[model samples]
Target chain A: MNAGIRLMTPVALLERFRPLFEPRGVVIAGASSHPGKFGFVAAHNLLAAGYRGEVFLTNREGGEILGRETLRSIEDVPAGAADLVFICTPPGAVPELLRTAARKGIRAAFMATAGYGELGEEGKLAERELATLCADLGIVLAGPNGQGIVSTPIDLCAQIVAPIPPRGHIAVASQSGGFVQAFLNYARKTGVGVSRAISAGNCAATAVEDYLEYFADDPETRVSLIYVEGLADGRVFFEKTRRAAAKKPLVVFKGGTTAGGQRAAASHTGALASDDRVFDGMCRQAGLTRATSIEEAFELAASFATHPLPRGPNVFVLTTAGGWGVVTADRISASRELRLMPLPADLRSAFDARLPPRWSRSNPADLAGSETRDTVVECLDLVASHPEVDAVVFLGLGIQSNLGDLERNGPFYPGHGLERVVEFHARQDTRYSELALELERRHRKPILIATELVDCQPENPGPATLRAAGSLAYPSSHRAIGALEHLWRRARRSTAA
Target chain B: MSAGAPPAPSRTLSEHESKQRIRAAGIATAPEMLAADVAGAIAASREIGFPVVVKLCGDGIAHKTERGLVRLGLADEAAVHRAATDLLAAARPADGPVGLLVARMIRGNRELIAGCLDDPTFGRCVMLGIGGVFAEALADVAFRLVPLSARDAHEMIDDLRTQAILGPFRGEPAIDRDAVATTLLALSRLAETSPEIVSVDLNPLVISDGRPLAVDALVEVRGR
Candidate 1:
């Protein structure tokens, strides 16, 4: 029961805000002269992004803003000046503002402020009054506490601030301001950009669930990521999430699992994080992948950006060192609930000829350390072509000690085989790049590379080769598993639909 | 021949009969008399107890909190007499009788709510939620189409925001899931079986130890 209840609300909030964000232009009432105010921030962002439609600003004694003129109230703003008015003022002013806005032909509002329904008794009355005003005037309000919104590339950054670089496939909606910004940074570094980033703060009038329905239809967004504290309606959210998952890759991060966290989350955002166990069951049934952290969230988003989703879970690890291969295989085996089969019988004999006798030639197909770039390429080709493996991971040795200076020393210290080792790595890097480019054309599967060294150079074939496949993050094996899991789910969802 | 059949009249009950019918349905009650005889009322209270809750319990006091017909925690015979006098004065029944009810004071940490309303379109519907301030503050409640199955009743108990309150949290014993389920089931059953009941409200159903005991209940029945 706990699990099911918590899972329902975030989805409900998302469903409620669908119409408010999709309008041609949303006006910010109480469009402030103050520098740090939400009204000022939202207006400045929208205008700078080249909003072509009407943007009417409202205040008590309306006049010119930074450049645009403000109306004497929502009533003074000419009818049809805007489709929606965003109230960034205090809750006390909201009822009157809503009353005036509704009279002047505004049909929707984004109440981007807190202190109502979240601040206890007095605030609750204020919230009820505001609801009454909306009901009377037939206005649709997005929030009494909301982070506003931003639709990328379309030049719609209604949020107080925009942290995303206006490009990418992933669209995100979060309850926390901090989580939303963190994801923006994470996506950029991972080479995955955002299509839209919004924070549905208190969801007084609209919720995250509303935007989800729009995102399900929005062609610009391919993968949808959600970070939630809670929702207003659980069953509505559950049904919508299930429907959205069928169309796009939907990944969610739900906070407030711990009792202390739930209490804090409630006080912070007025979100009731129902029960964790109930939420878990909902995610499973909806086919929505639940990410454990911010890192996993972005990694999963990134994985969906560049790779063809894996169908089932057969992963093959091909490497030059047995230890690296073993660790890579172990990570995948441990993290994924799927089966990782041994290499097929046909590829073994061909795999043996390229490596030295001392090489631990096993399922990972460890090409002897002394092997050249050609051997690495051959192993990948064999591994990728196999019938059993659905995904392939190549482990690259990206760093090697400089041997020129050491050659003067004894056999042990001298670049005894330093130059050869460096050359081997350099060749592997070049060959791997070519392999990555060639594999891109296949499109039937995805192959990723991992390495220990943080910096990969042209002189190092391993690093350069993997870099061609995609970007890399060091010491994030868990992130890698998250990536694979996302791709697998994304593919399965698309196929299942 | 079809036009010859007479239309049925709506059924309505006086306040005295409403309380009597509700008490007969396995619900507890305190001593009280609707008769204008002060002697009979005094006699009933003596048989009951010293401290008690007194209310006008009239059909007109729909929202008693606002109407000022409610007096709580009255102690001793003198206080009971004063409360009864105050309730009678507020009712302003100079012509004949005044309706009043005296109930035992119920104490508990948690307050839960159960309600049923007959929707003009959907027929009967039931609502269950955390009671008291949080119910209105959070709106953390669940609604079901009646008559609710055992699974539906359990889901309502499981889905609310403060569902943790139902379980033993913060050193409290787990709420009797069976009782909660039964209460919801009974409410649904009432809505289904008794078409005369227009709406029912059981606010602050106290959960002591593990069982939820309804201390206060009000039913709105249809009139003929």
Candidate 2:
């Protein structure tokens, strides 16, 4: 709340960037014949993503790249034929190439060229001139020195190296191109599918806020995930992200929330702000959930896409072991965003018939090891049936079934020892997880399941199938409770629209 | 927007003048009368009843309590006479015009803060926080962009870090949240429609008998 600062915003420049995200046709200005260059990889990524648009390639040598014939220059492409252009030329050559693309009526340009604004004073001057040129021609440029975009709606993957991810509801936009690669790597490792990923570098004309506003309107995107380094115009950033959060949850990994981190961000993305605490206040005002790490950001994203928002703050943890229930109950109690609801009389009565009398008749609803598969299913249904309970955290799913011990038991040790019996258990576990997913959909409340072992265990496909059905499984009850807390906190924010 | 002219700039508003703006916005302030003499102060105190506070009020006199110009708990006529003379003698206006203000001392259970400031990043923003001596040290406050809805105002009050202090504390009733929301929404409207004001700082908005009363306020004015 600093005074004497200009807070007027008569116009928001990040509006109407849909064509940048969902382009009709594209031209790669520097499609190189060499496989090592970025131009070649950019072209290859588009093809690998299964983009349906007519892709025109340009090279000075006038040859072919990936079986597509190349034009000697970009001017040869028909005017108004291509909606977007990827400038893969050097920094010095980008300005002239942008003029040619603008002359050809290209509406948006993704500049993969480096050394602009991020290098030094000379580069900054080049960036300033290029920024004016693009604005005058009414073209929204993504970057001057950056990585590229991965869009699922058009299958438009213009980035390098990282393969096209599956189409899902979470969209990502980051200031650091390298970190966007890391985000993709993390997404793949954690089974978090990305609908769109853009690493906007330098942001000469198109900024991180531009994609935020665009994704806010994208029907394919349910949660807009962001990694911001710095903002040239903080008001625009706050307004756009706030507007987007009103539509869906915004899981932000704001990189400069501390003094040391702000200094690093200035060196990294050239950000400027008086205090990071003011940014924190702005997030609260805008109703955004700020994540401390990339993993939390992804976890929040997956939770939003996979599960409906909880109706209230009360969540129930149903565990087979009393210890897991105690640990998860502690985690849930620690967060003000969520608390354990008392086991209602109806649920208590329902559990009395199925669960043994030794069951903990409290909020955690410990099953007390009397849970057969039938009892587990009934307990989950009971948890989902309650009106007072908002969400459920069920522990002891996969990897707890001891597949590794069956390996050590030489294939003939009783329940899951033989190969056929193990397969039967695996199939039954998969069906049980799928049933959990259906119950979640039927109740329209989040059911965050926890497993003791990592998913994709030796032969146990339970966790993987659960994850595939959008029932996210965490390795510990703490992480599961954390995810549920994030979900509930966002669900309770005022819809500031 | 009604009959009252917007507060004048080129100087800060006196406590009486500051309360006028908040009073015009549908909030409650204890009724009082200004007295220039000890005899007049005693009569005003009789009307305001016992447990009244006498203060030296004037332009640029924002911190009367720190200057020892404020005397609280003036229980009788004799005490009011002594307090009136002390405040009148200490009162000196650095800008122009000075006087003595005799007001009803509001009794309350808990203290809170409600305010409005123009933020560069989010434009006009309304704030609610745990107020008193530890307001700055704790820094436990929540803000929302102005032109707020009724829900936004309530959410600002609910977003405070010290929720335990606001509700049913020490065998007292909860702070009247609806009244707080009304006050905040009024300030938001004031900040939105009247550009002359820079900020409104109401510290220790005490929960007086299950109600929020602005006991002390300063409205900084910089004409638009």
Candidate 3:
């Protein structure tokens, strides 16, 4: 294995192969003083990101670029050093760069420029010549029309996009340049830190397969997300993804699934996405979680990173509110194959004795806001302590106010004042936070918390503490339930494997 | 998904012997004449009629298209007489005299392709698709491994992009699907049975109405 890694000389070799995930050094080959040149923008971003690796700028009129030495030719750079070379040169100049890189043993190259293979026969011939050169030298070249990679861990930003990603576990490999940029900025804003992001443009030499192999062993990457336009090699991709699933979760949002999209993908990448049914079967065999949208891809990966995989479908729902329990239960058991097991009779009787008779005795125990922090603590203790409920999803934190008198127009507390009513619902947030911490400390049943109060506002207590307390927090019960289901399936596959 | 193997032609054979194999298989081919003497060659050409194609039929030059050894549209008796003489002189070498296949020209608008490839993983598979350069350009081809069922044949045809071209378009009648399927199956069986056969190309499989005919054929084999 060491020999295999060593025979891959161009220090840029592996980075070129999976640059988005492991770009140690990135050089803009066609940097210029001209503002319009893509190389200028790309170099500016890499430097602005505080990249730690040696940065080189190559251009016709070589000079200082962001306090970095500019090399005029690839020959000037010592071989087996630079990990990634970005080709921001013109379309016609790429073939020469590829040949020069091959001679110098620069394996992985990102072609940020366009033209060739996409044009007519003349362009195809030029592209073919470059491909033949790479094959002969065993150098892996990325796209001539790609937006580059952004790795947060190494502080490597090869993209022209701003703000290098903050280090985290979610790794994204996308074929579309625009999508890659959008995902990175979104991850930063949403507090979902990204580990690595790759934009495999055109995939001339190195392909999605190379990235899959790299991420399989990537320790920083806990879960991988893919935005695929088309697959380069069907059989190799399927096999690699299958092996990858065993180690880390792989979530893919396969773009170009529609007819028009498929055509566009073919023209862009020179690939056939194949039939939809085949893709579905392939994903299933590979143990991949298919996300229908980009948001789901991010949400699913984020949830997986923070939470432990669930054991089974058995769940316990506890809420301070009434109607939310029904909504949570309905979403949890929406699948026909899944059944919502009722709370145990002994547990139900204990809850019934604590609350009024009309509080509704079923699963999703609705305490009707009469519960205190101690009430929440007791409820979570009992539910999580139960052998049947493998996981608990708690809704509505009671930390705000109203320690009691949850039921309005009820004689439980006659003539409850407005201050008392406000106090009753006021402190549930703090109480739920305490209960969430205690449950995690004791049972470790993987509790997922959400509340109606936290649905829109970002500053709810129960959701925040569920996250900090080593449990998952979500704005919606449906998201919490969906995340649980995903974890359950992943656990099933992992255990089976 | 292609099947079967094609039978090998062990050694170089005369044009007459090649025709005999096709005739034995109950298939019709164009007429051919190979006369030893000049007088006899001229007499044979006159008997065969005008507007015929002449070719240098030899052992080595199987890819005649690339060599430009073929002469087409020989109109008069004088044209045939002179062309045959020139071709015969070129065929004569230190080794031996090369025989020629004087065949009638079959004209058609449609060109189709059929071939047998011995897959390393899947064994012999026969392919059927659009003819000539269009097939290569469009890559509108489908393959079925030998010993295919009728359903498989239909599936392969439908899989092709030019499958619509095989159907009734404009005022023309639909091409016979059964005939194409049977040809694919037969090619598959042949390929599977004969490992010695390496490749086969039958281009311009002229189709009129429900009838399809293999007008031009080329076969390549392994070592002698």
The prediction achieving the highest TM-score against the true structure is 2
TM-score of chain B of 2: 0.91
The list of candidate 2 runs beyond 4 A from truth reads A1-19, A30-72, A78-81, A114-132, A160-163, A229-239, A274-287, A312-314, A333-339, A385-390, A403-421, A455-460, A485-497, B1-11, B37-40, B87-96
Q: Which scores greater on DockQ, model 1 or model 2?
A: 2
Query: Which residues of candidate 1, in runs, are more than 4 Å off?
Result: A1-23, A47-81, A99-108, A128-140, A349-360, A371-378, A397-441, A451-475, A489-497, B1-224
Candidate 2 C-alpha lDDT tens digits along A1-497: 22212232323322346556777788988889899999999999888878878788899999888888899998999987888888788876777888888898787888888876777678778888888998888888888777888888788888866866766778888898877787677666556678888888888777786677777767788888888877776666767777778867888887876778877777775655434545666677677888878877777787777788887888888877788889888888878778777778988889999877898988788888787658887888878777888888887665434563455466455545366666655665676677778888898988888876544462357677775654457777888777777777777764323
B121-219 per-residue lDDT for model 1 (tens digits): 223567788887667887677766566777667767766767667778556589888888887887877777776786777766777666776666777
Give lDDT tens digits, candidate 2, residues B1-224.
11113434545788889988888876677777777688888888899898898887777787887899889888889999888887777756463576677889887767788888765444557788888788889888877776777877787776787888878878778888899899889888988888777789888688887788888888888853
Enumerate residue pairs that collide in model 2. Answer: none
lDDT of 1 at A438: 70
* Model 1, TM vs. native: 0.59
What tier of docking accuracy does candidate 1 attain? incorrect
lDDT of 3 by residue, B1-224 (tens): 12123444454343444444433443344566766644555676677877777776765555556666577878877877777778777763632556666766555556677767654323455677787567668867666545455655665665566766877866667877777776666565656565655666666576755556665566655667
Alpha-carbon lDDT of model 1: 0.66
lDDT of 2 at B97: 70
Candidate 3: C-alpha lDDT: 0.67
lDDT tens digits by residue: candidate 3, A312-397: 77888888766778888898778432346787998988787677666667887888767644667777788878888878888766
Q: Evaluate fnat for each of the predicted models and list the values in order.
A: 0.00, 0.17, 0.00
Better of 1 and 2 by TM-score: 2
Interface RMSD for each of the candidates: 14.9, 8.2, 10.1
Assign candidate 2 its CAPRI class.
incorrect
Candidate with maximal DockQ: 2
